[model samples]
Target: MQGFWDCMSLWKLLLKGKKGCHVSSCRVRRLMKKKLPQAWRKSAVDLEDCLKQERSLYKQAKHTYAAQWRKDFLTVQTKDAKKHQWKSRKARDRFFRLQQMKQREEARHRCCAQSKGSTGDLQAIQIEEHLSDGTTSLRTITDRRLVEDGCMQETRHAMIKHERRHSPVHLQVSKDDHVYFWPRNPENKGSKPHGLHNGHFKAAIQSPSIAYCDALFRNIPLTTGFVPLQWQNLMNFAIKKKPGDFRLSKMRTIQLMNSEAQANNKKAGRAAMQFAEAHSLIPDGQCGSCKRHQAIDLALSKQLVWDLLILQRRAAGWISNDAKSCFDWVAIVTMLLFGLTWHVLSSMFNMLSFATRRICTGFGDSKRSFCPPSAVPFQGCGQGNGAAPHLDLGDTVHHSGEDICASVQAAATLWLGGIRATGGAINPEKSFWWLIDFEWDARNGQWRFCRKCSAAPEFDLKIPGLYSDIEPLRRLEPDDSERTLGVMLSPLENHNAQEAQLVSKGLGVPHLFGKQVYKHLEMILRHMLGGTKPGAYMDANLQAHQLETGTSFGLLQQDYQNTSILASDTWLKRVWKELESLDMYVAFDSPALSLRWHHDALLIDLFIDLEVDQDDLLWLNWCRMFLQVATVSDITTADGRYIRQCIWNGFRDDTYRTPYNWPRTVRPGRPYWELWQRTLSRALLPSHGQHHPLLQPLGHWHDNFESWNWLWSPTVGLFHREGAAWTHLALAGSSTISRRYAPSGSHSGTDSLQ
Candidate 1:
């Protein structure tokens, strides 16, 4: 009975599978393996394959069901286009027509009033009479399309020149013909344009106003090197680097130069330290006691060593990266901290409402009639003990009363903090002034303008968030009548940055005096040449070199009729002829140039001009001949009469204006000519050095030995002084302007000249 049951079970299991064999359990496999190993193994493998196939079929059916559900339920609903269609074309046309009419009216109003409306609107209104884009009429559409296509097709339009000061169209039209703008079309042969003038037509000849020099005019190069290696040169070198090399050569060169600079700085630092020690600025073993000692230590510190190198290089006009090294990084960090400190100080000054002012009597009368009780002009601010506190950038002195002394002191402290934060206080020379009146209302902790004040309602000077009741703040006025201290900041006329920088680094001695001297000489020369008035010549002599080589010879315009040049008549004439022939120089006419004796500081009021050409031989001959002729006696004429050479006693540096006029006026004196004589003479005494006297505070020279020598030197030569040395003038003459005296014989001082 047991055998039959087992056989039946086996048969049942084998028959359970459809399309494949089935093994119900691993236990059955184990039993079969013990009884019939091979058969059991095969059946087990078949069962596993059947299971995998079933799983894949079930998965495929499930995905199909999900896809069908999504297709039916997740579809987006859209409205029909037919339902949203407009009911009628008439309504749409009406709406567009109304918009067009509104735009047209707005454009017309704008055109009449000259409002800053859109250009499209203006163009639309102008073209509306011929064609309207809003109109549904075929003619209107066709016209619009034709106009656009015509504009597109036209390759070029004839250019019509117009007067810069005149408008193309006039609003006050007298007729329909005048209502339109000047038509650009060539076919229109109507009345001439309203603003059209005969400017292009030839006019009657007229004489020029300003007289120019007859000598060759060479425009000087305005840029020059401040040092042996200028920053611009370095930049040029950097720009020439090969594109593919990643600028390695330029960078390497810079690095090498930087290293050399570092070494030099170290040497300088050592020398400076030794000098300080020798001067007793640094005590033995006490390194950080004195400011000098501290400075030395700071300079020598590894962090600052590179910074000093970079600073020195920059000052000498070398391009250098400030933050390219460790020193720069340290400096950046320090400056950042300093800047933060300033920001905090500025915030405090603004928050605390710190300010200073004056309150007292007037100049003309003790009674304050000139100034109202509520306010006063800047001139009538005060002249008493209660005047505004003396607050300046450097070590400040508070002039406030005891009651507000503490507040003023606090404010001063903040100001000092700001100065340190900004690296230093502003240069007194660079400070500007403006007229302003500050009001304070402690009650509201704010400032407001007084309605009765002379300033307009819009011209209030009150700064927001500041309050002070001690006194009203009166600032320096910009008005000519009220301005007391500084000139207003304005854009420089004909500004050239490169030229300005070059001029700044030029001539240690002041050049303005020389310019004045030149002007005097020119006037004298003109009077001697011809006693003619201005406007005697209308045109200038154009040189051949100028026409062909594009190099200008002589000024663009000159008045040669009034003055004449003789090739070999007088000494000046001969000198001028030779100089002009050699393309050297001849200047008795340049208003801003003056030749002077380098020795004894003797001024050569009139003589041959300098040859600034870069020729060693030419310069040598020039200086030799100039000096030879300058220091000699009068030349003997053909008729046995001595013709005194045109030479005058050199003017002093202080002599900006001359009292010696030619009895008769050739031209009206320069602005403030007479006034400058009286004012400048008293102000610029020898004892006063470069400083002006009590009357005027502005000084011509700084309080230094170099400045003193530059201003007061009586024996310095013109070529020897200032940047003339850079022109290779020092190669020829005794660096001094003076030469050894020659015995009486010929005009030239040298005996060698036969």
Candidate 2:
């Protein structure tokens, strides 16, 4: 029946004589139009083309008739002739519209048919056609089903879904995992590196009674979060049992556990040795000074041991003199209350750590190992991420030794108040000790303590140069570097007399960059030769990742879909491996780089003299690769394709601005330096994303700005410039080089250093 209606519609087009079809027939045609497309598909033969031909013929006939009518009407000159002409014109326009509708419908039907028969993939096929008139046409066959603007985006996203699912860098994070990477037992294959590896960070320091022990020995106030009940009982017991000299003698005995017992008490030292051996504090076979030192260290860590020792010291009449010299009860009480007050206030507003350059030591420095152990989850003081608490006693203004001790303890306790407020506890795996010694200067008739802080050359080492007559003091003992608070009064160390100095603090600008380059080379070498462990990946959980990727890439962990995952590409890893095995280290003979401080907070402030070998291709190539790899960072995007580019160009110079004075590469080697210079030129310095760029500073201000300063503005954009400013204090201190190495202006003309 639908086919019959379709045939009737075709007939209606042929028989133009009929002004209108019957109402019942039109109703049947409308109903058939809905149902007959599939049924007539096999029989369809381009009826719309036939209709076009018929319409053209009708228009030709009409024009002829109109011409004759006009000839006839030329004599008539009547309004009726004009009226008939208007009617004809209206009929012609209506037919043209109907023809266009039919053509469009037929084209749509043909497209749908072609789509159904297609067996190829969804890839767009580009069609190019050359015309005789020397023109070409291009057409892309796309999925018409998803051709809408929004749907096309959805289609693109689906293609890379597998890559996103299979990514290894974004592994699932857990509550137990420390926010920062920490070392775990390499032996325990099953255990994750959650900061809880045994011998990594012990849990004994978390005990409440240690506060009382610290209070007794150092007269320090109790930590902010410690429960008062535990302290009250421990204090009561210490007061009731005044063991006096007996306790001191016992500690002396325990201190010499490995030595043979005296004739008067033959079993004492042997029994102590047996206990130390059982606890694995000392090696079973070793029985000497080393074993005794280890046992003393282990014993001092225990609260019960401390309590017993305190009683013995009280009995020996030594506690009173020691307490009088160091303990300031009034100050201790004041600071204890101050910590508790801050603890209460921190509930509303998070307590913040102090911001200063001196306190910028990162917990992740491999050599210093300042970070607390894995077991102690450092939530960080209220100061935000990358900021560490300042525990340097020299920062205190107090002059008296006892007052200084009291102030340092108070500061530590108060800092802990903030830590405790956020559910973090100290890890006592290793004691953190501060060695204080005063040297008597006969020239000035005063005693002074030397604090060798790492600062600029202007503030060099605090050597006692004033007292020339002062003799060499005793050397620091092996046990002096212990972590916990143990007051050992000893003379100043004869630092110059010893073959090896106790402190190896890198000083001045030269040592700073030399150490940095050395370290970077070492790290690259180590990773390349040995191949870093597969799972040694840093977590990118910064909120900026989500914000920049529009929340598509986020913290939510998905099941990995790929067969394998890698933190770095194979080429990168291979490059490092090759560099590691390179015997170029021996061939690289160059003068040491010299650096001097100029007191500018930015790289522009300092100057460096680097000796580069222009003739050595190996050195040039190494420098190029090192600079490229060091500065090239992969921008985080939803798609995994690496858009590797230099992220530090904001700190370098460009054509418009000769701000950063990067070292000049000469003649043939100029290309290497030029390429590096171009990479650094990627970012516009001080970009405000505003219309007028003229307002921003140029030249020296642009080049020497403290781009790495912790308090520096985020707009300078040495690294990440898109979202919130990344404020890692350590990054600011060590991430830049002296301006002399990176001199401004072109070195295009000559090869000489001058």
Tens digit of per-residue lDDT, candidate 1, span 300-385: 22112222221111111111111111221121112111111222212212111111221222222122112121110111101110
- Residue 287: error of model 1 in Å? 64
lDDT digits (tens) for residues 1-754 of candidate 2:
2334445455444333234534454544554465444322332234455445556656665666757765777667764555334354435644664565456557766876787544232335445557999999875656533333333343233333423211121112122222122222233321212222322322322443542342232111111312222111100011112235435312211011000001101111233334334544443323223322333222222322222222111110001011110111112111111112222212111211111111111242123212111211112222111111110003221132333444444555555444334333332211232323233333332224433231111221111111112111112221232221232321222324221322333234556444645654554344334432210111111121121111112212211111001111122222233434442231121121111122112111110012222232223222332232211111111121222233222122221111121221212234445543332233322333322121222222222212222222243322221123332221233345632122122222111211
The clash number for model 2 is 21
- Badly placed stretches (over 4 Å) of model 1 are 1-171, 176-754
lDDT of 2 at 143: 54
| Deviation in Å, model 2, residue 250 alpha carbon | 23
What local distance difference test score does each model get? 0.25, 0.27
Alpha carbon lDDT at 190, candidate 2:
19
Predict model 2's lDDT versus the native: 0.27
TM-score of 1: 0.13
> What TM-score should be assigned to candidate 2?
0.17
